[model samples]
Target: MGGTDDNSNVRSVKMVFVTVGTTCFDALVEAVDTQEVKEELLKKGYTHLLIQMGRGSYFPKKSAGGSGCLAVNYFTFSSSIADNLKSASLVISHAGSGSIFETLRLGKPLIVVVNEDLMDNHQSELAEELAERKHLFCAYPQTLRSTIVIMNVDALLPYPPADAKPVAKLINRFLGFPDD
Candidate 1:
C-alpha cells in the first residue's frame, strides 16, 4: 500500500500533488491550464503544489496561491509516487497504469488528468475504465475547469478489495519479483 507524510516542506501551499511518469510528455499535456479550474481553485483559497514527473520541466520560482494564481512545480520523481502521494491532500495526475494503481492503493482522492498527446488516446481509455470501477474522479481538460469545483477530496477514498491477495501478486509480478 502507498503512504503519505502529513508533514512536508510543501505545507505553505495548498498541496495538489501530481505525478506524470518519467517522460513529462504526459505532464505537458495534462498540465494544460483550464482557466476555469485555476480560477475556481483560487476562489477556494488553494495554492497549487505541483509535483511534476519530469526533472527537466520548467517550474516557476514563485506562486500566487489563491490570490493571483501561480502553479508551483515542486519535486519530480525518478521512480514511483508512493512517497509523495502521502503528502498530497489532493492529487491531479496523469491517467497512467502505475499512477492510477498507486492512487487507488493509497486510498487518496484522485483527479484523472489524461494526456492527449500520447498513445492513441490510451490515457483517456484508461481513465474511463478506472472511472467505471469507481476508483476516482475523471474529467477531460475542457471539463476539468468546472469539475474541480464539485470535487470532494474526501469522497474519493476506495475500499480495498476483499480478494487482495491476487492484487498483491499482480503488483509483485509487475515489480519483477516473485510474491513473498
Candidate 2:
C-alpha cells in the first residue's frame, strides 16, 4: 500500500469491496485474485479487499494464500449489505440492479463487473447503459487490472434530486405551507 502508515497519522488505508451476488462468479473473483490485480490495488493504497463470493468455486488468492488483508464471505443477505457498503471506499459488484441502486444510493464509487456467463448476456446492455450515463464503470475479467488501475472516485458525478418540483410542492402543501 502506498499510503501513510497507521503510525504516521496521515490518511487511512482504504477498503475495496467486491460482491459476486447470489450466484457464482468464479471468473471475476479469480481475475481480481491475480498477482497483478493484487499488487495494483495494494499500490493504490487499498489495504483491505473484502469479497462476497456467494456460491463461487474460487476464493480470492490473497485470502486463500494466507494474506490477512483480504477477507472473503461465501454468502450474505440484505442485512449485511448496508454495513458492507458503508465500510468500503469502492465497490466492485456483479451488475445487478439491487447492488447498483444500493451502491449509488450510498454514493460509493462502483465498478460493475459484468458476469456474461450467468445472465444470458443481459447484463451487458444494462452495464453499457449505466456506464454511458457515468453512473458507474464496467469491466470484464480480462481487463480487470487496467480498469482498476484507472479507477477514479472523482469521476463519479452528483446524483440528481429524487423529487421533481411538483412532488416537492405536494409535500409542502400537505404540511400547510402551500403556494409559497
Candidate 3:
C-alpha cells in the first residue's frame, strides 16, 4: 500500500496548502517567515501555497512565487481548490483539527506546522500525538527545513482505515434531496 505512483499526479511535484480554520491566530505572523521554508522546498523541487482563513487576513492579489516555488494566499475557501487536498501529493499545513482530518482522510503525506499561542497549545499537542501514532508528520517553523527533507509523498498513501460512517441517524432521516 505504500509505494510511489508514477501515474499519480502527486508524484509530479511538491505542494503546500494551508488552512487556518475558523479562528485567527495572531502569532501566524510567524508564517511570513515561510519564505525561508519555501526556498528550501524549491531546492528540493516543490511548489508552495499559503491559504489564510482568518477574519482579518487578506488573500494576496499576486501569487507567492520564487526560487521555483509558487504560493498563493486566500482569505476564504476557494471551491476550485477544495479538492487540492485530495489531489496534492504532499501537504504542508497548520495543525487545525479540520485540516488534519481532511488531510488524513485524503491519505496525503502531511507536514503540519502548528499555530502558536492559540487554543492552549491544543493544536501542537494534537499534532504531536498524531505524529507519534504515525498518523502524520509534524514540525515547528524553525525545524521545517529538516522536516521537509525527510518527506516522501509516496510513503503516505492508500489509507487502510475504512472510511467512517455516522453513528446516529439524521434528525430528518427520511428525505433524500433531489439533485439540482
TM-score of each candidate structure, all chains considered together = 0.66, 0.75, 0.64
lDDT of 3 by residue, 1-180 (tens): 678765644335456565555666434424433566556666666665555555535434446555355655555545454577866656767776557766787777787887665656766876887787677788875677777777665655443455311201121132332322
lDDT of 1: 0.64
Runs off by more than 4 Å, candidate 1: 1-13, 26-35, 53-61, 64-71, 157-180
lDDT of 3 at 49: 56
- Candidate 2 lDDT score relative to the true structure: 0.72
lDDT of candidate 2 at residue 160, scale 0 to 100: 49
lDDT of each: 0.64, 0.72, 0.60
Q: List the residue pairs that clash in candidate 3.
A: 64-71
lDDT of 2 by residue, 1-180 (tens): 797676654346477888877878888889877778877777677766778888877755445222334443334334466888899988888876667767877888888888867636756666777788787888998888998898776887644437234544554465456565
Q: Highest TM-score, which number?
A: 2
**After TM-score superposition, what is the CA distance of residue 115 in candidate 1 from its true location, in Å?**
1.5
Ranking by lDDT: 2, 1, 3
- Candidate 1 at 133: error in angstroms? 3.5
